[model samples]
Every structure is written in structure tokens, then in C-alpha cells.
Target: MPEIRNILFVMYDQLRHDYMSCAGHPTMRTPNFDRLAAKGVRFTQAYVQSPVCGASRMSYYTGRYVGSHGAAWNGYPLKVGEATMGDHLRKLGMDSWLLGKTHMTPDTEGMARLGLTRDSVIGARVAECGFDLWVREDGLNPEGPDGFYYATPSPYNEYLKSLGYPGENPWHDNANAGVDEDGSVASGWLMKNARKGANVKEEHSETPWLTDRCLDFLASPQAAERPWLAHLSYIKPHWPYIAPEPYASMYGPQDVVPANRTEAEREDPQPVYGAFMNNLIGKAFSRDEVRSEVVPAYMGLIAQCDDQFGRLLDHLESTGRMEDTMIVLTADHGDYMGDHWMGEKDLFHDCSVRVPLIIYDPRQSAGSTRGTTCDALVESIDLTATFIEAAGGEVPEHVVEGRSLMPFLRGDTPAEWRDVAISEYDYSCSVMAGKLGVAPKDAVLFMIFDGRWKMMHAEGGFRPMLFDTLNDPKELDDRGDDPACAETRARLMERLSAWSRRVSQRTTISSDQIIARRGKARSKGVYLGVYDENDLTPELLVPITGAAKGDFR
Candidate 1:
């Protein structure tokens, strides 16, 4: 097998796992995604640590669970000094660069306490989730009466203005919002304008713009100097469901898949689930006309994303870098898209939690596994471990809770892989928590999926939610409160309890390092049970006796 040198870590926001043609979307065809999948291993049951973007992406970067990292919601800063992809890769002489969204807020308070300014490289990396930036754009630069979402002017919006795009914020007005013929701005934030074409040209939209920047970086001299991990994160197929130009009109109601929900799901829904179902986003998507108008636009954005990936793949092939570079195409978290009477991601539905994961490892050893689909339970943090190993370094197991997928890539099953896939959600920031009258600390939810049954455990005294993935694939029926499933619920709850007790906080030292340092105190002259000099080995007392000619005691 040839050495894996570079990693093109690509991510699309809110891309459902089942949307790609390779993943079996009957109407929406993703030729580029299928092309990558054919040359790699596609994971059918890949799950994220969190359902929301910020928390999920932080899990991807940090290689740890949400509970371990503590960045449990959007805008919640990942603690300073948290180990990320770059932190692991740097030790192996690999550089990690960011081209798009991380949704990572800077840990200003932690940095200030440590007297580390963001201007310094170390501090800057800490602020940027351990990656040096080529162009760091989190893509949502909305401005309101309160203030701007971004502290500074967004680089993407500035690029739009330079190209003669009219408006103060072309990112919001042009790329995200649709301009009606009558000269009114139809904000994409409102799902009603989703059927209309975006105000900007196809090339000027977020997907293409970020793709062009990524190509420039890949072609640059700096990129050629060393192996690097380019996190080319595209902020598309997420919200603002507006696609520019031809992509906007590519699909319509005919191509829209029926929402996988039923009226039965609404009957006696769990309290927290009921809150989300009653929310604005949920209620809007619950209507048939809204799904007809919005899903096509959502599909169009994904189609555009696949086209952009085609450009990336072609560039790598032409440059002869495909042989050595590993490409991973995945979403931070899947969008619910009105699945199970809910819109936007949160909760444990497969539509939201199970993201599409395609990994193309350009190595001879991985050739046999190409074009195969692996059903082993994979987590978002596993990519972090895979990258560390591919970059010629071992995974810091104590820090990275996820196991590497390299074994799967090499066509081998792990001796003891995990049976359950876990995901967490922090609803303290959501309106659902307030509606439920739950305190911030108790506004949490956990999921444990063991291939057959899916169980959701909510805090604040709510009953467990259960879904039989084998029997009820669409999860229309909630077996959560069903007394018949008591044994299954208890078994899954025990798995969750075992997972929560894992050694997640002691990350600075590895288990192997601790093992090597075991019984090391004796060599350093602190033998606790030594009755006399004869009680210890002569060599072990060298630290004391071999010191200055004084009493060995």
C-alpha cells in the first residue's frame, strides 16, 4: 500500500444520508457523490455525536463526545486547548487548513484567563478549532437590529460586492434571498421563497465560491510543500434553501419525496417532542405545500454540492494527487426535512442523526474494499482517528473516544467494534426547553442505537422514546411508552449508563502512557512498602544510594 499523504476532508451541512443516489434516493441523482462512493467505502449507518451543526462539527474536530468536550450547542464555544484534528496531525508533520465553516466560536474567556491573544498563531489555532485558515467562513452572516452574526465583514459577502453585486450584504440579499421581479427581497429564511431562484449567479453562490477557494489552495505552492488536511466545508443544503441559477430550477414538486411521517406520530407525542412539533419550523414543514415548495430547493442545493465535488475530484485527478490523497465526503449532520413530523435537526431520527459518510482512501491496501458499503456502526469522531492514523501517527485513544475506520477501509472487521451508536442533544438553547419548563442543565437528550432498536433518553423526567428500525423503518410508530418493550429499553439504558462512565475527561495522557509509568515511583526512590534496603531491588534504590554519599533513607 502506498502511503496516504493528504486528506481532503469535505463536509456539506444538513445533507441527509439517503439523499444521494448511491444511498438509494430514487429521484434525486448525485452522480458525483456516486462516483466517489464507487471508488471508496460508503457507510450506511454513520451517526454523529450531536444532531445540530455546531455541536456535531465540534465532535468531528475534537474526536470526542459532546459530554466530554462540553460544546453542546450552537454558539457554545469549544473549550480552549481542546484537541482537534490539527492538534493530532501537527505532531505527524501534517498541516491542517480550513476553507469553510466550522461553526466554532472562539473561547475568548479561556484565552483571556491564559493571557493568550488571538493574534498569536497558537491562540489563533485554538480559536479556529486547531486549524490554520485559508479562508474561514461559517457562512451565516446575517445582520439584525441587535447586531451582526459575524464580528467582522464576511469575506464571502465582500467577494460578492467586489464583483458588482448590489446591496450592503450580498451574502444575505443575493446568495441566500430571492429577489422578486417586482424588486422585493424574498428572504430564504422564510421557506415560502424557496421555490424562487436565488438573487445571485450560480458561480457566485456559497458552494461554488467555496469550491473555487478550495481549488486555489490545493493548487498553491504552500499546499505542495507538505501533507495537509483541507477541511473544505460547504455551507449548503442547510437553511435558506435557495439555489442559484440553473440549480434552483433543476427540480420541482415532481422530484420531491414524500415526507416519512404519519398522523399517528402526532398522537400522544412525548412532551419534549411535542414542543418541537408545535414549534414554528415544525409546523411550517408539517404542511404538504411547504414540503412541495422546499424539498426540491433542498435537493437542488445538494445537486449543486455534488457538482462542486466533481470539480474537486477532477482537479485532484489532473494533478495526479488522487493516488496519495484521501478524500472523505460527509455531512456534519443530516437535515430532518419534515421527517417524522419534524423539520430541522434535533432528536434521534435516522433522517437527522444518520449522515452520509463516503471515504476514498487512495491506497493499494484499500482497493479491495472500494465500491463496498459497510454497515458497522461509525461515529463522526471516528474520522478524526482515521486521519491521525493515515497521517502516520497512532490515535490518542484517551483523548479520541472513537475507533479508527482504517480497519474497515483495509477490508477487515475490528475484533470488537461497538454494538451501539450514541448521539447527544443539548436543548437548553432551544425554545422547546423553555416551552417544556426544563432548566438549562436538564435540557438534554441522549440516543442509543443498536442496529435494531433506537432509544432516546430525555432529561427532566420524560419517558424514553423507542423506535424499532427493523420493523418500523420510517419510525412512524413510537414504541417509547409501550410496556411490551420494557426489556429492550432497559438493555439500551444500561448501554447508555456504561458509555457515560467512560474516561472522557482524562485526555492529556494516554492509557498506554499511564501503563508505561506504572510502578515507576520505585525507580524514582519512593517505594511505599519498603521495610528496609533489602525490601527493594538494589538498582531501584540507586536514586537514593547512588545520590550523594549520605544516608540512603
Candidate 2:
């Protein structure tokens, strides 16, 4: 077995797979991200369970689908009792720690119902999505007329105060918003001001601040003896669309590639897709001006993220931890960046659901696959199973719906692998649902992509979307209404129906334990059935035959 000691699992928010140089972006280069890919295996087609933040991260942390975990959207609580990657790693004497955002809302109601107090260890772990938080910052500290996004104080805000940014909400002014000549706050939330840079210093920015915290935790003297799974989750490259000084101006509109949309998409859009296109954010991204301003800022934030990766890699190498540690660099989900007539990650487009996944395992077993690329269909939840397997533990398949990628990392491919990639979106409470006149439960969408064909099934009596990726790779054309594609759509729908019928969440106990219990029940004269006399042991047969006849009379 490969001797892996630690896990450096890194996640970037709202990073599209195609944005990285390693993944074939035309202009935006990410050398540090490419460096890790060259030293490891880069997955060409890794997708998240959901396109949004909270639901996607919950799927990743728990190795379960959004429907399974029941945390369907942002601000939705993950119901207590779902086992997470941290919970599984603990069984093998490993500690899982979080250095940054999880986007988790504690299941306060579930805890209350179960009488799990906040002071209790089990309660705290359940509330934290099963990881010990080293420093928790969801990074969206937007302050509005109502209040800050999160009502509580932020450590990032506290750090800004220490740096002489005196304000009630310096996070908005110094970090997320820019200052005008008149000393007015140009909030980054405004799409018009996306071209502007942030007021904070690059070193004090969210990305670098979170990276510094990780470095400090790794360098601490009182580190735990058990192997550690440090989740260095960054909230950058997601929003505010602003970077500090040098990174802010690193790229211009000229550096941005053209948007991946066409007039054809708007000609006769799907009812559900059209409703989303009319959304405020989507309409803004469709305009040439908004794309010109925001794409560069988006690239700048990504550039800063890449630079931080370089710093982290240098530290690990200098400390001689590179060889013993397994580093996984991936994003929670991708951003639209004006693709498919969308602005954010709410649809099933590759720009929204597909994410970059790079894994660097230092074991000699991984040598053969170095600098390689795997085209296998992968899910974000697979990382949970991979982490458990790498730490010398068996994957609880009853709980985890994803397969491990260890075989691929070790230069081997499993004889059988999933041919389709699945992604789901719950838009019941979204603005799109209101525009489409659909109930919340009827606004759900599930995508089934079988490498070449992509089919989307929407609830609320919406027409299913069919795209022949082999022909219309850009997904500019929807063939759901095309009679010629009926068979293809039917086949994919059947596959999706079969997938949904899987027996998920049935593994609270091991198969061995279930079998042992069967034997124990049989020993207590509880026989389910017997087809023949040979089916029963002599002791069990004796009573039925004649041994107890006189006693019964």
C-alpha cells in the first residue's frame, strides 16, 4: 500500500474548469495550477453534484448527493446524522481540519430536536459539517440596508480593524468595495463597478489571508500526531469580482475570450432556460459592456489564487512535506462567466457544473500516472471516498454514493466505470421559478451527460432539454423538441430513472454485522423459512420432526 501521511485538500470557489491554463483556456494562464497538474493526474471531466455553493460543498464533504444529504441550497441546513469525510477519517486515526469556508448552516432545529447542545462535542462537530474549524470565513460579508450577510462579526473584519481600517463594516469598504474620489463606497456587488479594483492590500485580501492561516496552522508546534486532512478552502475567484492593485490590473478586456453564447440560444429558448436568461444577473452578463468589465476582474481574482497556490507549494516543498502529503486542488463548482445565457452557476452547462480537479499523490504507486490526464467521468463526492481509502480505511459504500479514484491515481483503470456524469439543481425557491410560474418542488432539474449526449429533465411540466454534444459541442442548439432525437432522449431518461432508484443511505451497519445478526436470530429459533429439511440444522429439525412430540402433548 502507498504510504500517505497527510492530505492538503484545496478548494477554490466559482472557478470554471476551462479557466485554468492546464485545462486549455486561451488567454488566462494559471501556471501554479498547471504545475500541480503536471506533477499529478488532472481530471478532464470532473463535475460537482450541484452548481451552487452550499449544496455543492455539502455533497463534497459528505460524499452524498444533494437529495441524500437534504441540504439543497444555500442557507439550508444539513440535517444532523449524515456522516462526513471528517467523520470517516476519524475512524482511521486522522484529523480533518478546515482552514476556510464551508458555506454550512448549522442544523439548529435538528440539534434542538435531538437535545444536542452547542457545548457538546458531538453537537459542535455536527454543526460544523464534521470538520474542526481552524478559522471559518464564508467570505461573503456583504453589508446591505438590512445588515451584513452574516449577522455575526467576522475574523477578516477583525483583522482589517487591527490594520487601521476603522469602520463598522470595513469588510465591505476595504475588502469587497472600492472607494471613489468623493470617498463613496463603490460596492463590488454592482456589475457596473466590476472593472474597478478593491481598496484592500493584496496581502490582506481574502485569498492570501486564508492561505497565511493555513501556513501558520501547518507550522504550529502543537500539531496532532495523527495524520491531518487540512481543507484549505478559499472563497476567492468567486465574487466581488475585484482583486487588489497588481492582480486587479493584471488582465484587461482584451485578455478575455469571447462569451460562449449565441443569438441562436435566444431565438427560441427552452421555457425554463429562457426564464433564467431573463434574470437580472443573466441579462447583465449577456450585455457586451458587463462582460468586458467583469471577465477581467474574474481573471484577476483567479490569477491571485494561482499565485497563492505557488506560495503554498513552495512552503510544502521547503518543509519537505510535499512527498508525504497528498494534495488535491479542485473547485466547488464553476462560474458561467457569460456562458449559455447565464451569469452564475445555476444551470447544467459545462461552464457552471464542470470543475477542475487535480490530485497529487506522492506515493511511488502514483509515479506511472504523473503528468497524465484522465477522461473518466468523475463527481465531487468521489474525493470523500478517495480520502478515506488513501488513509487506509474502507469506503462505506452504503453511505457514499461516489466511487474512489485510487485506481486511476495508481496508473490503473477499473474494468468498469461510470459512463455518465450526473448533476442536480434545486431552483424551487429561485427567481426563475417565480418567472416560470412553478412551485418550489417543481423547479428542480437533473442533468445526465454520457460524454457525448447531454439531457436535462426539468420538473414543473417543462420540456426535457437534449443536446448532441458530439455535434453541437457549444450547446447552442437544444434538440429536445426535435423528433429525430427522441430515442436518444428516451435512453438517457431511462438511465437517469435507473440511477434515482439506487438504494442510497442504507449502510449504517456493515454487511458483516447484518449477516451476524441473522445467525444470532436463527440461534434463538427465529427461522425465516425453510424450503427443505436440508435447509435446517439437525437441532432445528429435531423439534419439528419428533424429538419434542411427547413434550408438546
Q: What's the TM-score of every candidate structure?
A: 0.97, 0.96
401, model 1: CA deviation in Å? 0.9
Q: Count backbone overlaps in model 2.
A: 0
The worst-scoring run of ten residues by lDDT in candidate 2 lies at 544-553
lDDT scores of the candidates, listed in order: 0.92, 0.89
Clashing pairs in 2: none
| Each candidate structure's count of clashing pairs | 0, 0
| C-alpha RMSD between model 1 and the true structure | 2.1
Q: Write the per-residue lDDT of candidate 1 for residues 1-553, one digit (tens) a residue.
A: 2298899999999999999999999999899999999999999999999999999999999899999999999999999979999999999999999999999988899999999888999998999999998998888989899888788778899999999998789888889999877999999988889978998888889999999999999989879998899999988888889888798899999998888988888989989889998899899889999999899999999999999999999999999999999999999888878888789999889989999999999999999999999999999999999999999888889899888999999999989999999999999988889889999989999999999999999999999899998999888788999999999999999999999998889988888889999988777768797777888776886676754667779
Cα displacement (angstroms), candidate 1, residue 119, comes to 1.4
Candidate 2 ranges beyond 4 A from true positions: 222-224, 511-521, 528-536, 541-553
Model 2 scores a C-alpha lDDT of 0.89
Mind giving the per-residue lDDT tens digits that candidate 2 earns over 1-553?
3488899999999999999998888899899999999999999989999999999999999999988898999999998888999999988988889888999999998899999987888887888899987888888787668877798678888989999987877778878888776989888888677767798888998899999999998887534366889999999899878778788788998998988888888887889899888898888888888888899999999999999999999999998899889999999988888887789888898898889999999999999999999999999999999999999998988888888999999988899999898889998878778878898878899999999998889988889888888889888889988999989998999999999998776768866677778668767776777787889989887666764436654
Say which candidate scores most in lDDT: 1
Deviating ranges (above 4 Å) for candidate 1: 532-534, 538-553
